[model samples]
Target chain A: MAMSSALQNGLIQLQLFEEYSWVFNLLFYVIFVVFIFYGQRIQMYVMLREVEGSLFKLKYIKDEGRKIAIETIKEIGKPQTDPAVRVDRFLEYFTIGPQSLDPAGVVWKLEHILDIRDVRFKDEVKLMAPATDDTQAHNLENTLEAAMALNFIYKIIRHFYLLGKKTLSLYIIMQIQMILPLIMREAEAYASALKAFAYGQPIGDGAGALVAAKLMRGHEIRKVPKDCVVATVPIEGRTTFVMKAEGPGGNVGKIGDAIKTVIDENEGKIATIIMIDAAMKLEGEEVGEVAEGVGAAIGGPGVDQFKIEESILKHHIPINAVIVREDIGDAVSPMRKEIFESADKAIERIKQLMLERTKEGDKVIIAGVGNSIGIGQ
Target chain B: MSKTQSNATTRISSFVLLIIFLTLALSLTALILATTFFGQGNEIIAGYLLLIGFIGVALSTYVLFQTRRRMLRLRIEIPPIVTTIECRKCGFKSVREFQRGDYIFKEGEPCQKCNEKMLITAIYREVKDKEKTA
Candidate 1:
């Protein structure tokens, strides 16, 4: 009976950890870390699968906004694009609106493409609130991205710390350790940006778009693209077409195509093309600071810039620009009070500049060139 | 920017969490009473009771931290200021907190740098932690 009891005691005692001397523990940790990396990759892959999953739960946009969001997410999830391209595509969608099938910010196109009924689309848009603004709209998207990235990185770290018994192979651990600081910095940036988004403040970059939306005052406006709209107003007797991305939806509709369509309909009679957008300021420049300049003063992949420039050149028209200065962070998050307030100032500036440059009866094109995500025309 | 509204799951879990906390507290108390038998010759039972108490402490601590963190996150406030004043002729501007009377196109002070008219052209707030915005 005593021998049997001793045998049971031996069975209960776990010496395997000490016997293997932690090598096995280290291997397990490495494997866990590797598993975490793969898990993140797999999760990301599954999120884009017809976009019917938990990732949608993380999305903050809903209803009509969801309509735009689903299209944007699907585009970003295109498996064929490279990682860099995917990021670029995401930025483009958030800032510029959907491309390819619908280059112009046309409402009917979205309705047809998404197979959304016209009456249903209208009702969904009616549910949109102007207060949602461009910065606030994109901030939600950034928050989701930051959260996903942070969770992935955190899981890797936790797996290693837990499974590896807090120690591992020197070389690989050293490599991970070295890269961790840099990764940490990137993570820090994401964290701050997420906080900025949470508060619904405008990033420094979104000032131009906000000002453009201010120019629209946009009740009863017409749709041009995803989250983009346009309105025609006669300024000083000149037929002016004001275009901007639809507000409260984080859509930067295709401003270039919108301009092209107006120019074509006007039969190249656009005398002066005035573009207003937010510009990144040099150090010492103030946020919400407005400036007037020559040329387009529009920033993007040059697709829209080229289209606007070509159309202007074809019409032999003079192009003027007004720019709002802001930092990169403020450009894409929520619309700040200053940026929102700057809209009034930007509107006044645009009016003065257009009056100064164009004669009465001139067909002038005033385009608010920026991501119109939260900024409605 | 958009408002961050809490999901339904968070609200439901909050009630569930309170129940869990109370139950765990009672369980830890019972475990401690069992541990008093350590000197009564039931040492193995006392040891197991002590282990359960330790686990309860760890779980309770985690739950407490999680609750506090989530509560703090929900108390997001609105940012005080949103506009920036800038110069049209030259690069001069100032940022200030929002006032009730503030609106677009309202003229403010003259430019500090070039003496041009400094108009309130852009309204935006610099985002920082604890600074809420609309």
Candidate 2:
């Protein structure tokens, strides 16, 4: 009786399958697709959670930002007791991509970028660090690298997201979706970077400080009331104050504080204030192209721009800007050969602009604005 | 900037080649499946295969259209690199396509007007925006 009933049930089931096979296939496809999508998504979040946890474990901070800078450097690549090697290693990692056609050209480019005048990078970094300690410099370099990693990851996400939204095409969306794994990898890098910054590691974005430090080499670096260091450098026979965030280990320092302090010390007797910085270029613009115009050439939070504007207006100083242009990728990622080369070109442009705008012996303030990480002052 | 032109061309041509290959393969696969289904005398399955072939054709056409539109937009998006040549002596200036081995301060061809060794005073990417008129 049981066998007969089982046979009858199998017959009925077969008849039903023939009737609803298409429905069954459709249902199976839907479930499979859903499983793939949700399963992959869950894995993505878990991966991110793991990275965040790892980054969080490597926390350290120094007076203001010393320890953070040291640990950040240690986590980024290798933490070494030798500060000089540590610093060198950290910078080498920033050039992580393809090699330049000419390494000499890259050095020439680095020189130009700093407008170093007579100062060597080694001396400058030594002066900029809290006390020329190699450990601090190493830490500083690490912090900057972390910041750059963050910038690269964020830019990638933003660039594709914007491209997809603007095009509003299914193909574009699908393409972005395909590269989500790649984006997630960049996100992991950013997590480590953010952890570094939170620990008070200085950012690589403090490029302005390095340039300023370069110009200030061979001069006495005096800490003003602000978080910045200032030095008097004569240019075209004019008294010019070059200021950068006193850095070796990492810091975008308090640029507004620096700007305000220097302007206050000058007593409204400034001829021209020229700001040189890295600017975001348009899609067609070439990396390292130099552009000159009026106003502040700073890139960051609005606070610095506001402070500079307020101080300049109060002092009745005519301010001008010279910028080295970079695309989104170049601006945030490790310094590329092209951008490094632009620094050389930017120096020439700045000299030309300063000469055209100010008379000899005119008191001027030239602020190289950016994170001064891995940069000596 | 000199690399922009070559990069765009390389990218577009490669993309075009890929689309052509895909379309050809898709068409061939669809034709083979449709013929086999028909040869098997399963008219219902043959009709379904034929329908799928038509859908493939429609998709290929849509993809081609989208690709062409993308190519045109990308062309407009990249600003042309304009090389500015200036004579150091006479200061006569002219613009041309950025040539290889050109740096901002490096000297290039002699000036047409002054016959002086002209400097590559500036190599900038300039956007020539055009307004669409109905």
Candidate 3:
């Protein structure tokens, strides 16, 4: 009897459902239409929302960078007036790269522009922080530069976000969303860089410089052009001239000029030119892994690489490179243990390269090519 | 900066989370109703209700996962930096939190072992392995 009664109730519910079937069908159709017409729009909204979240985070990072810059300047520079305005202005400062329409002599043009920019920046930094010494000033300048990078990143992302919102263009929104992760990663790196610069700590980029310092320690040091320094050390009976940016300050000294000078001073008789630097590692590669290759391993606007290549070619010198592998984040942030330890390994590679590539009493030039922040000669 | 914009975003996200949870609860209720209808032998009603409940659950779960990924992307944590000091005379080494003026190869306080000045030999971040998530 209980089963029969349940069957009866089921029949009644079934009938009621039939009665409301049109309502269900109508609701389904409406939903299907809405999805078909607005599916892309909905997806775009979701992406926009995600981008908005990242944008907020970027803004916070940018603001924190600015704050740190101002504080460091105030603490070290001891400026008389408030530096907030000046800091903001400096953050907005920009450099227009040299025109490439006439590609000939572009490198020199770029070098000229870079020199002027550097001079102007130093002047501005000195004016803002009169109390700071040369090293302190350079460190402060690096810190401010990081802040400026963060500021620029935030503004660019904001511009794209606003543009996408204004046009409601899915393509526009999609493009920014696709690369947002990479952009955010770079911005965060710059954010961390501010601290490294402010504290004058050795960063991963200093790997090469550290190796040079290790080699040149206790040797007679001489200053070269473009804020570079060189020391003569004997390795395996070869007179090795180790060169690096003058440091314990944040500077990737004009490496190209330094190399050129060293070669000219030696009367173009330098047997081998070996460059050491930090390189971005590929996926699955270990940090601090040392690799040797043949080329100028310096990374920048290609100016230093060009100069080094030119000088080496003119002298019929073979250029070899020993690179310590690191990631983008590692390059900017404070030095990691693995990367720091790799300096010794890089030095080992340099010594081995010299022994294999050159003979006894041969004059060799070993250039440690990277920013020399928080590293000494 | 007031950070008014970020505060607004936080509020909006919270509201969104609440709405998603409410929708999830409603979806669970619909699933319960569909099961009840199936037990009563109301196949037609059970079929429609089951479809609706399943769609709701799937959509909500997807949205929840996406929200989580966005949150994870925004999380930033800075690691601590340490300075390693080593005495040249006795090879005694010690590490401490990094000080502002500390740089590689800088001279530090006299060593406890040999009374000779310790050199700031290395400064680097204390990297920690990230925890594996299931």
Candidate 4:
């Protein structure tokens, strides 16, 4: 009997121990989940604060015109079905209309879109008084407050989700270390090409082709003169800048316009109008690689690539383009090695083309199409 | 350039770190439970740990495999287009065509009349033309 009792006790002890372990595990998992949630919440809060600060700083800048632009953009904001579509619509509105603001205008517009006005206590009280009784009014107010709170929570959660996604995307980008050297090399080549053109050194098939096309199209050309006025326009994109120069001589609107005017004034001397712009590459494209092609011109806001293209076509000029395809990031940033190498190759091509088209004395025009930000144009 | 690549590298490393963390957490919990329940000869508990480890490794391996496969499939679907030019100096014309980088021209060079130095200018689709012809 004693033996059987002891056996029962042993079995009960084992069962209790097993149950205890299970409970402990459950508690551990719960704690772990709580830790992760809290950590993420804190991270989200920090990001929100940073974004809010940037927005506030933008608002404080003394620009009434920008403020008005912002207000207008905010009023026009509607829920978009697709993110890309929304961005495109925003860009259209931001760029096309007479109301279109520059980058400063864009900053103000974003600010007004995100602005939140505080609810007045007196107004709330007045609204509550419309209720049948004090109790009812109080209840209505409470409900409204609850709804507002819920809405606020929803917005916060949405923002947190966006932040998390951005963070994850950045993390993924961090892992691909193999592509950087190529981007740098390309950026440098691009910068050097611009510099060379700015100094009036005849380089590349693109330069020559541009000259030939310009001359063919009836743009006036000049042989390398002792002192020629050269204008540089840098075409900027989402990533990189393509700097090109117009053949020397002629003062017009901006550098781009100056080049166009020069071509117009010296008609019949220019052979071709080659517009060098940054091109996006397919996946697995080598960094800083040059892809020569005849394609549509691409540029940023305020730099009218299309206008240039139209002008060229209007004059019946045969247009050729020498595009250096760099990864998106390298295109925007300036002075990498690849940009220099590509520029060198492009210049070499232009030189070869020039030798083929005209004698040593023939003048050519090359326009660097991009934003003149880092390299002082 | 360094900064951009570093960002990508850090992201991949973080993923690996996350997997390691989850595995460690799982193993630690199992160990704690095993110590509590299987007091003396815990060989069976050790076996459970081994099983969990195997499962974790398998899951991670599967994730890596899926990611690599997706990348490869994307590459095959959108291979880079290389431009080829048949410069017929005799004809005084250059015939430009889009070709795959691996494709070989009929004349073993880019010239139209006789084999001569040819430059690849642009790449576009030949498949659409072929489809139309068919």
Candidate 5:
């Protein structure tokens, strides 16, 4: 009986010892196993959480962009239905570029696709905002397009993020994290563009259009092909035929077609095609600084530039480009004072080029290449 | 729920969590200091206190970072636009707030100096400090 009592006491002492030390031991073992077996997983989860936070911010920016679009449309368009639904649908619209496997007629095919997309987008805008005039309709289209861009960015980022989370792929998460800042910068740019487009303000992209407008102002304007306007203005005793995308509306007119038409009409007698455009400035470069170069100087899907190059090569004509430098942010956002002032500088450069390169009474084609949003001819 | 409302709720909850974590970190730090300086040779207690204190501080920092980021995201503001008009004949210039229909090269009211027609020569926003990229 005494031995039995002693055994019971020993068992009680063992129980008490375990009760005191079990928590620390369990913690130590759990931590050791987690660090050893699931360290990468824990790291991935932490990064995922971080990415999720950024994703949330992106969503907010996108939603704010959409809200601005809907409100602007409702205020200006006075649409019969709630534009929110139509705007949401329009935001999801996509365009598929033509295949280039054969590479023979891809440019024309791409241009045809772009034409159809443009018409469809305009028709969608008109259907949604039937009460708007032509100018208002164009502005609304631009605003919605910016909103659509934001939505696309958000969706794409969210796609990679969710895909990463689902597969627990550190590489995917790292890729997204590395490029997140650039993506966000672009998204913010589009967000700012919404305000400019909605209000029909001139953007830095319109610097080229502004230069043309200033030169072509008070001249007898004529319609060229594809929503473009041309006027004959005398610059330094030379007869200058200046052309630009018709404006006070948001349009990057069919510049390639217009240039082709103008060249065809003149029968290859054009001396020099002076193109002015807003060029993306390098870092540390001053905004609105005008630099002269030789090329097409147009920024898009290479369609218009191709056409210009083809026509120039056929006629063996000299093409000079005067670019007004602007940051990516400035290109789409409302114009800054520096950019607005650059128009005169661009004009002076063009006049100088004309004097040095062409003879008196030579026919010079000065094409201002940009989206003439709020600049009139 | 709407995205805005959801964002508001998330922001509020994050703020509350930040406060809680900060309070916890402060209390843990204080306890650690007290235990270190005045615990009178209780080494085990001090060791545990130090570990707990660091963990608490780390959590608080994480929460603080998140809350600050959300606040920054919420602070976006739209820029205001301005118009600069100048007369071609007299070179007189005037500045005004931008209207809806304003465009570059569009003729505005007559000039104040010479009664010549003033033209909308510029429409732009004043440069902000944040936009200056050195």
Candidate 6:
């Protein structure tokens, strides 16, 4: 009778284990579904934030420039002719003037009176004017429609992201509610594993490092000592780099001079300069997604991109850019595996490129170009 | 600036004072009814009503004071004449005078002359000389 009781007890224990396993599997499936649904939505929010920030900045700049333009116009005073007559004469020029005289040039001349520079974008403005005798008749309904469509898409994506985040939070709460006791029992093991992952020595042949090296093909990679001045430039936007080499001057004109100095000083030691930056993503593109592109100069107002491009060209240096495409909505999330993978791939590619470019005594520059928010130099 | 206008202002203030007394009387009547229906004690309900009444009086008084002060400080001045250049390509033109928060040109408005969209080129307040006494 005692032997039969022992067998019954074993059977009950096995049944309990099976029941627990079934519950665990159910929870796992629910969490997986929540992650998939909300992940896309979170990405959309980040993109929106990015676009909004850029638009705000652009508007600020334009407003300031507009103020300056108005002041200049006021100082110059109106033409001697009657206001209506002057306007009439200006309109007459459009009909009778040299056909070769482009709309941009005409607008530029007008803006020149106001001492407004960079009137090249006047054509875009002109394209949106009304068809009244006093205004340009260009119908911009199509463009406005396109803009509205883009806004709608962004809103939909953001809605999804918020939904996903909420679902994830709920799932976590549910898990805690159901498995609080179990979690408490295994807390010690969980803590130790986390600690080991954080500070433990490289494991399993340094797979991460090997993956990074493979991605950085065609570039030379040399682990330089910390505090070494790899590359530096007085660029307009805030840039965070692993090793920033500070040079003289703040304006765009001095960019070439600074780059040349840095390159010359570290010639044999430094390999290629890898510039990682935030790039505006086209509509429908994923935020925080990384793309490898040939580095192009993107200087702000008064800082011409051509001048910087010319400088790099003059030095015959290959500038590779790993751009993080994001939108206006603080759309950057650390949890996105794709972003991390892309970043890793970029780093690996840069490493390989550096190794290929540099010889025995070369140095490499990896410049993380963006607003240094939540990212260390 | 004129004696006649100052007298007119005093008359308006007196009229407003009369209106406030009537509003207070009406509100007190309403509070009494509310207390009766809600089964609240006279002192407790009256205290609550008094608080609300005081706030209302304070807000109205502040608004009235501001309006009166502004009327007293009002200075009639001649408007400045301005010349503007309307863009032929886009109806975007330089307007001489615009009040704060006014849109000189809205987005996506087409130009009349060149069939281009109008973009605000300039916005400014016109400066004019005060009329001289003969």
**Among all candidates shown, the one with the greatest lDDT:** 3
lDDT of 1 by residue, B22-132 (tens): 868866885877767765645555666777777887787777776666544432233344556778888777877554334344565778888887765544554564532
> In candidate 1, what are the lDDT values of residues A1-377, reduced to their tens digit?
99997666555444533565588689999889987878654543343331221122222222212333333333333333233333333322322334556566554344344333323333322232223333443534544444445445554554543333334333434444446545544443444445443333344455666655555563457876445577887767877887776554334456777888888888998888888888876667766788888897777545567667878888887888888876554564445556666767888888888778878888887787665432333
The docking quality of candidate 4, as DockQ, is 0.02
TM-score: the better of candidates 1 and 5: 5
TM-score for each model: 0.44, 0.44, 0.89, 0.36, 0.86, 0.26
Chain A (candidate 5) TM-score to true chain A? 0.90
Alpha-carbon deviation at B49 in model 1, angstroms: 48
After superposing candidate 3 on the true structure, give the runs of residues whose Cα lies further than 4 Å from its correct spot: B1-75, B131-134
Interface RMSD after interface superposition, model 5: 4.3
Best by DockQ: 3
Give stretches of model 4 more than 4 Å off: A1-256, A295-298, A301-303, A357-363, B1-134
- The lDDT of each candidate is 0.56, 0.56, 0.88, 0.39, 0.86, 0.37
Instruction: Report the TM-score of chain B alone for all candidates.
Output: 0.53, 0.42, 0.76, 0.35, 0.64, 0.31
Which candidate, 2 or 3, would have the higher TM-score against the true structure? 3
Q: Give per-candidate clash totals.
A: 51, 19, 0, 72, 0, 67
Error of 2 at A208 (Å): 3.3
State the lDDT at A46 in candidate 4: 59
- Give the candidate order by descending lDDT: 3, 5, 2, 1, 4, 6
* Model 2 Cα lDDT, one tens digit per residue, A8-94: 866775676588789969999998998787865555445444333222221111111233344444543353353444443333333
Candidate 2 Cα misplacement greater than 4 A, ranges: A1-207, B1-134
Which CAPRI quality tier does the interface of model 6 achieve?
Answer: incorrect
Cα misplacement distance, residue A37 of candidate 2 (Å): 26
